[model samples]
Target: MIKCIPMIIKGVVQDFDNNACKEINLDSGNKIKLSLLTEDSVLRSLNSKEKVDLNLNQIVNFLYTVGQRWKNEEYNRRRTYIRELKKYLGYSDEMARLEANWIAMLLCSKSALYDIVNYDLGSIHVLDEWLPRGDCYVKAQAKGVSIHLLAGNVPLSGVTSILRAILTKNECIIKTSSSDPFTATALASSFIDVNAEHPITKSMSVMYWPHNEDMTLPQRIMNHADIVIAWGGEEAIKWAAKHSPPHADVLKFGPKKSLSIIEEPEDMEEAAMGVAHDICFYDQQACFSTQDVYYIGEHLPLFLSELEKQLDRYAKILPKGLKNFDEKAAFSLTEREGIFAGYDVKKGDNQAWLMIISPTNSSGNQPLSRSVYIHQVSDINEVLPFVNKNSTQTVSIYPWEASLKYRDKLAMSGAERIVESGMNNIFRVGGAHDSLSPLQYLVRFTSHERPFHYTTKDVAVEIEQTRYLEEDKFLVFVP
Candidate 1:
């Protein structure tokens, strides 16, 4: 914990001041100094990494400490943090607390076990026996697990990775996002307070540094860690991969693209309003948030109008980025004024929204700001080809029942998650983003295919469903 303090500090700097995060206003947007001993600075010092080294005992202690802290006062501390965070980020206190409580629940819950086992939709049941794999088992012991949490600007995506490591009883060294620095640190502080002697407390580290800062710190830490968990965009993932040691197991969580396929909208007002939440949630910063919507029916023009009216309401809440507004204006001027067809495509007060409607060849364009490329299609099938590789993460359907009829076709379109909810926030946040979850990435799962069975003749029977079933159990009873 001591050795990695600087790393957490560095990350806090970037989380608070990420070019995108800093552009928005939160709590007067006061700039704080967030820096660490640079790579050069570390080289100048003697035994820089020595302070963070830990034996097995300390690692176990840290995990216990984390459990105690979370078990005691996580909710209260998190509520306080949420209030401050809302003020800092300029978000609604209600919304912030809701999201914060969700994060806290995820951090403290034992749900990672379910997230890993229930890979598919199924009822929960208990298994009485132990399963083992080659050099790994159902209860695999991890020694030094270094978790590099690549935070998304979205609410709790980053914390999932950290929670996963903790559940596995790994000595977690979390690299939290620079955009939201203190969430993880505060959680860790809570643990340190509960039982300072716990190995998990001594084992945990939360800090931040710029991607360009001393790569050696993370590299060394990664080399020491048995597993490395990372979450972020392509650039962040690429950097983490480069810095991670060759022998370390890399569990990557990268940014994903999502979309909405609407069947019909009564009018433009309705379509616009429904799609507005997808764009405005966390300012459309979530990886699963939709950047494009393709309406599959002749009702689109009316849908667009209804969408516009509803969007106008949201414009009062969240706003668009300055750069995003300028770019759209430039495109509209040069491409002829009628491109939007008299549609009001401009920045609103409070940077609440930026609605852009233009004729696009397809929905393949990368999403930016609070923008969604509204594409009109004659059939939902016609839009299938437009889903690029990144569509593996999200596709929310309007009136999900009708969409399920063509579900097979939609799955072929490469979407991992489909729901009736038109808004992205309706999608469960703790699950995997592109076919992988935190537990799937943070802990290794290996299975043994060998079968172990005891016939009635081979073992004592516990119960019989009926007389006929009892006859089948006679062999075990005789034995």
Candidate 2:
């Protein structure tokens, strides 16, 4: 069967044009025809500046309703999306279902959305109205059109990019990743399904062009962006940075590695379970996924045994996704190298998971398909040398309280986020992603200064600047 995905422009689904369509083959022997945008359509979308009159609450409410629909397992669109994920992306049945649940959770958490805005922008009302801050009224204004260059490794990332743009009130133009084009389009279709003419829906455009094939359209779109958000490997991030307008704000969610540190764990089973979840989820594709494990205390042998059991259990629960020939070959090579190096290696049945415990720090390639390298260290500080800001995004520590002791050092060493071993996927409110608040970059903070009649904090009486300067009284009010 063939699935035809149409381009969405300003809330309207475009008619499929054979001349402007790209067909992608799935591993399941099916095909997907994705609609492409032309130069004329791009200009029309750029010129159409329909204001989003809906308030923050209104947008949240609509998204919550859509989320409710997704929560229903029988929802037609939800079912189709999961089916396509299984077919096109080779996601297991359980993983596909989990992805849908995550989307629901993201949209249904209305309070979190409000909290995110308040935490990132100072106040929830900053987007809707100016709030008095210090001596002036301040508000965050959207930075016009936001261009999202999404990575397909994690579908939820694309959802997050689009959601952030909508929450910040910026118009969104998303270029779907070739590896997973269904997610963003499905999300946009849900918006249209809820209310086609809704401003939030109308404010979005989802289309795709190969990253390397067509430079003309991508460059033209990049030129119109007020902000460019790039999510993917180093090359993708560099392309977005190079092509984006010189004045545009470019936010990069580039490649970064994460690791776990287990020190004197009370319950070996519990700690093993948490570490397994971090490694198994997304098959180590996400930046927060754990790739290395550093054990600080004793019982290294016991923990390895527990970890192997947990990995086997998770393999049955969420089975690994399909890997191409190159990926399979790489996985085999890494295992062979570990064996040749005299390291302790434990693998699941049918290559479900691979674990290599090295006596020393190993610098081997991480063939990330539920593969992790473990290093046994005598002290926690020993891991510091390996942690650096330029590449480390997350450092999950077991025995939650251990974070209190090592968080400062980890932050200084370049870890962007610190969390409990199993909770890497749950990014709490008020936390900085990639060491910065992303919403801050999506909008401009504009301040309306208080009038001269308003008394200054230092000067009790209202005074004009000109009078103070002429009378040589400026220094008198300095205190």
Candidate 3:
């Protein structure tokens, strides 16, 4: 008899090669290998399933067990598990540890514990005060739901969606991302170690399958689930949405990009240098990390030149990943065209960085290839339109002063959140998921009771009347 638990838990565990321990190249030169169980593997897992029964009471017990175990094991003590994982995956110990720590934090924040307590206790202190408490469906009476999570690449994203489902008191069916299934599997085991009978455990199911057109598996999962929460590109979101029943609520986190603004120069040199790091960190893989920069001032061109110089200094210190090659190639292509402006773009064929001038034209030309893509703009206003068109998530204002003055305008422009230059990647990333760091997005909520309604004022229409009514009660209209 094949045990479902161990069979379902298999993953890539290879010998650590010294060369493979280097930083991962985002490009992989198209040599990327799928790490998780492919789509076929997923279907096969389901096909062999003799029984797919979940008992909520038992799952909840498991949740408690896992949550407690995670809380007991401090981050430092848990480092070894991820260190082993890095060795297995042939990645540098540093990168693996960082990614693992991030995932752990995402799974159980200090705040997450508070959130779980508040949820089980059935409190509605915060939810009552907020507007659009995030798209609710599935009547209050629904119980024991299944959540199908489609994870994204930027580190620790799975935590947000998984926690939300738990907080909502629904069982989860998490489909791990091909790029990162091991982390999720590790998380599940952590729960079992803490408490084998944690109630929440019985309610959750984590699996990975190739993307399939046939709705058989999804339909089965959906049939049992009262809610479906998915995170991915627009196409993945749409697929999940199409399969979801009207009764099931769908929270889809989709494609988004972010930029930063450099308004004034208390210290132009230092500020520009700091902004450059935001672009380059994590090899520019994060959505919130700076991709484009808007500089405002008379000597803006000089400022961009100064930024290029600073970027060069940092480039040597940071590890060269795969994306560096593509960025270098792109810089060369732009230079040949002669459209690049600012400090001399110096990344050669073998170099690991690309620094280009911000195009003066609004052709959406990005100078940095992988980690950073900076552009200097004459007016700060020009950047707003770009943000609106592409949907920027975070806009880090250089000087602290601009935070107050320009916040409303930035919000009006459609940015979901704002942050200081240094804090871009510190916050969690996903859909509408922002930095302040609440565990609400992670685990299950014990009690979520908030009323919702739209008043006439909420949907008011203002009209400038041409004429006032005289004898009659109604106003007269003029053509």
TM-scores for all predictions: 0.69, 0.97, 0.66
Order of models, best TM-score first: 2, 1, 3
In candidate 1, stretches whose alpha carbon ends up further than 4 angstroms from where it belongs are 1-29, 35-76, 83-95, 105-129, 132-138, 193-202, 265-274, 313-351, 362-367, 426-432, 445-479
User: What lDDT tens digits, residue by residue, belong to model 3 across residues 249-317?
Assistant: 666566667777887677877777777777766656566767767777667666766776766755565
lDDT of 1 by residue, 121-189 (tens): 121121212345332334333435565656737646655566556544566666666566656776666
Q: Which tens-of-lDDT digit does each residue in 1-479 have in candidate 2?
A: 57788888888888888789889876555678888778777886777665676678887888898899899999888999999898888899999999999999999999998998889988888889989999999988889899999999999999998888888888999999878889998999999888887889899898988767878877888898999999999999998988999999899999999999999798999999999999999999999999999999889999999999999999999898888777888899999999999888889998899999996556787899999999999987799988988799999999999999999899899999999999999899999999889999999989999987898778787767799888988876666
Which has the better lDDT: candidate 1, or candidate 3?
1
Candidate-wise lDDT, in order: 0.55, 0.89, 0.53
Q: What is the C-alpha RMSD of each candidate to the true structure, in Å?
A: 9.4, 1.4, 10.4
For candidate 3, the clash count comes to 31
